[model samples]
Target: MISPSTSQVIPRAADSASTIKFRDLDRFFLGLLVLWASRAWFYPGDVETQIGVEAPFLFYFTLACQLLGFYGLFRLGPPRIGSALMSQPLLLALIGWGAVSMAWSSAPYNTFGMVRATLLMMMGCVYFRERLSLSDIVQTFAVVTGLVMVGSLIAAVFFNFGRGTGFHVGSWRGLFSHKNGLGEVSAFATLFFASYILAARRAQLWAALFLSVSTVCLIFSGSANALVTVGSGLALMGLAFVTSKLTPSKITNGLIFIVLAAIAIATTFTLVTVVANSLGRDMTFTGRTRIWEIYLRFAAQQPWTGWGWTTASTNEVMTNLVRTTLKLPYLRSPHSAYVGLAVELGYTGAALYVAWLGKTTVSALLGVARRNDKISILRASIAVGMAVFGFFEVSAGVLPCLWLAFLICTEPKKQVGPGKNARA
Candidate 1:
């Protein structure tokens, strides 16, 4: 385990969010990435008369912001490359393999664009880690999610936006176009905020309030996957809080983390099964099994290389194959991130993804056990979320949450001098 660098100040802070430079353009750009991934109200409806912005304009604008955000990162300082890459080797491998796979992508044109966007998003996450302390970062996220929750409440009550489609009708969509999207954000908020409150003794009222409201919104969203993921995350954080009060030695800490991790994993898996069974649902994971079968069939044709990174649900070839092969309505994703990556990136990519996620989660779990800090707990919470949420949604690929959380956790604390952090 790497020693907590005297230079690394912000990694253990669950609170102490002072005034962030809210006017910073790079920060705004990162915020845009979150808003974009959240499927917020800004990008709603058809191409023509789609709110006020045109599709091409929005596309170029987003691209330009990403490019400039990269520049801002360089302007800040060279990243701690050795520490960053060493901490998350599989992540770099995943990206490297993804770039290579574009060469043979069945949807070559589409794949290139998708891969580039993913690369940019990951870069943006690194930039965010450099620019803001974890406390400020989490606080900023809390603020944004709070706004989203408020918007959802208003839309559900005043407007006609709550009665959404699929799985459960009349589910709340909030600021997003769909209830599943709503569940994703709401549950995310609940997970992070609950972890934060657990780690930090102060701000109970606000954090608890936010957590409660987000949990309610998550339930109202009615996505079984989201509900299960959120429940798992909250339960893990609660357990972390309970264990934190004990004064354990380093060896004891490791043992505790291992025990807690095992318990959390087993409990979450069992609860998810129970939750699904209670809903009277089959093992299809809401029609995902058929899609998974189709992808597996296609995958068998090129088990090693896959059709390339662009050949998942959104790929034209995938859509065509699904349409031709299955009588059920077409599916855009295999719905499982692990399987989806395998379809696009093959077994090698899938292995890297799993390895990377494991490292990220384990490292944070260790940190939480050692420090007994809310910030560390929050980190582990997000890591668990990535695995849980990614199981049923193509979240790791399309949503900003997973990568953002990973990059932030793995990023080395910015050093202001030989033995001091920027915050210090």
Candidate 2:
């Protein structure tokens, strides 16, 4: 017995509900894609042996997923792919340089694979930035990483799939191949959940729960580097929040941030020293300085253009050289992102990377000044944290999770006008 207007309104309401359901489904699928790209789950084994080698089934399955993801991203039609690419000119330059290095690479095939992976990962970041709101991206990551943490706990408790070996013996690695991997993921989860709690008015209970779990995981993973990284990041975030309240001027805020950043760096160094001493480690950072010395010597051999992208760890000859030099049978990475980049692409590539980080830091600070949102503050903090973490870990080159997070944080904020979808 409804009137004509009411009948029409009923259908419109139903249609809106249907659209919402479809959007939720779409996001669910995207979350799965994200989990895959992040490598949140991998077979338990020696991480060193797994790198640069993949099972046949996994290789093809991943290839299919990437192809399908690329197709879907384009088909869904992001608003401004060109603009997104343009905004990350330095990233593009870095990728271009990586591709060019294949020409000189002793293992051109390996370099090609590494460059392709980097390009695809970058494209995935662009899609995330252009198609989804920052909040949506953060929420997806939070949920995915939360699940990972929970699964790790279950695996460790039920299946005895937690302990590490060979120097990291007795540490909890959980679902990751190494304790450091778990630590990195846990640190990221903590950051994501903390940011979510600060930004959201509702559903913060879940974020708080996840944050607590992640903090526990971080502690159990026993990665001093991850602990330091997260601590520095949180400190910077706190500073940003404080500065945002104190001033409206971008210049003043920038000055304040610079001062705070310096203090944070000094404090972090002190913490590192204290942690090292308590852990019975020397100033050499458990022989990392010695490794750096050897890496620098190799890098000096090709100061302008190194062996090739990813060759620092992938090429058999380079691996043998490092193993023989370090007198260790197994070695996975240079252990320093900056040194790895310098070894792979030489000083020019390292300079470009530093320049990009500087640019992103400035942009993040400006965003905090302009928006004063938790997301902006988190972005600024993460930019600073990653810059510091790169000194001790291979956070830049091949680590999918860290690199993806970096891309998301560095993306420029979009402007919304009246009559447009604000979140979009």
Candidate 3:
């Protein structure tokens, strides 16, 4: 017979082991939850339809995941709510403004729902940033996106899913409803894997494999916007790398780099315009300019506070007005996050977004100047990528995977004090 002391110790040890196992299982489930909430699969209708009228099943599933994930995070431990809120002041302000817009929203119900979803998503991002290390977050993104790339290939090859649709006949949309969806995700995957490869001291070969797959998907999807986003990311990465090497320290050097970057961006924009004209393409960006023109005209009518957050796509009257004005079939979105923001929340929201971008950019510059580390460079690249992608996509306007990634990747480093561990 065992002694009482030994028997008690055995139960205690078993409990300890069980706790460890539970923690691991919790992490696995949370990762899956993140993937589910990302809306990685193809929506049945036009992309704008997703914003206004998501499929019932998808909507409920995502809602459940978000609720569960938030609960799980709280169970893990009381989050540093103050720290999380302080880290994303402008983002919180933007969401608050969106909430306030519900008062005048054409579709107050929809605005209320979207605002709640956005708030939950932002909270989830904060929890993710708080809980995971930078490397862990990057790896999680890379792995999830790698699965998407692999699944896309399988869907395209065997099931012929998301292919051969009318005007987009030859484009390989894979598991996405549209080619641009596939392209955008693939572009982001490429960036994630690239960051993984750069940061990891080992297992780079695996990261490279995923990187290649993502690149191939990006090419097959045939999205010019995705191509531009990837190019912008690469350019920013290159710039960050160069800045880190040339001036690893000094605020003056960072300022100088910023000036050079501004000049380069202007020159690049001018060259792109010229090149598009030379290639016999209209400067309309495939009729997007017309859409922008019409949207801006509407926005000017409510310069201070527009129709309300997410009204551009959800409000029937607004959608009808835009469609009738443009006389274009299947043109629901403004096709630009900036324009969408201007239309939905007016100039106030637009200014807040600009301020947020400026804050992120400054933080990135400071990070590179201070640390000159791979993570800092990755953050800088993402900041630039978002700024560029926002011009062509509703990247910042909604609670999408891209926005989540931006929140996590560009978050400023937390200060660790005595007896404190940064990673959960």
lDDT leader:
3
State, as a TM-score between 0 and 1, how close model 1 is to the true structure.
Answer: 0.82
Candidate 1 lDDT tens digits, 1-424: 1223422444444433443343255456656666555556545552222234445765766677457435644645546533343445577678778778878887777677766666666666665665555544566666667677877877876777555644446788877766767887887787777777766656668778778878878888878888778776666655655555565575576677679769767876687578878887655457677677888777777777877875786576567778677764435567788888888888888888888777777766677667665556777777777777887877654334533544453444546588666443
Residue-by-residue lDDT tens digits, candidate 3, 321-409: 88888886567678888899999999999889878876786677556655565666666666666776678877444454664555553
Question: Please, what is the whole-model Cα lDDT of each candidate in the order they appear?
Answer: 0.66, 0.69, 0.69
Model 3 residue 6 CA deviation in Å: 41
Off by over 4 Å in 1: 1-26, 41-57, 77-87, 165-168, 267-285, 397-399, 402-424
Which scores higher on lDDT, 1 or 2?
Answer: 2
Which residue pairs show collisions in model 3? none
lDDT of 2 by residue, 1-424 (tens): 1122211222334456766675465567557655665554454456655544455766665565455337545745555555566677887788789899999998899889878766766666665555554555666766877888887766655665676766777777877777877887777777766756665535667778888888888898988877877877777776776677677686787678778768877887798689878988755365787777888887899998988888888878877888888897777778888899899999978888888877886677666654565556657666766765677777544334554554553375544666343233
Using TM-score as the measure, the top candidate is 3
- Model 1 clash pairs? 199-374, 313-332
lDDT of 2 at 118: 69
Between prediction 1 and prediction 3, the one with superior lDDT is 3
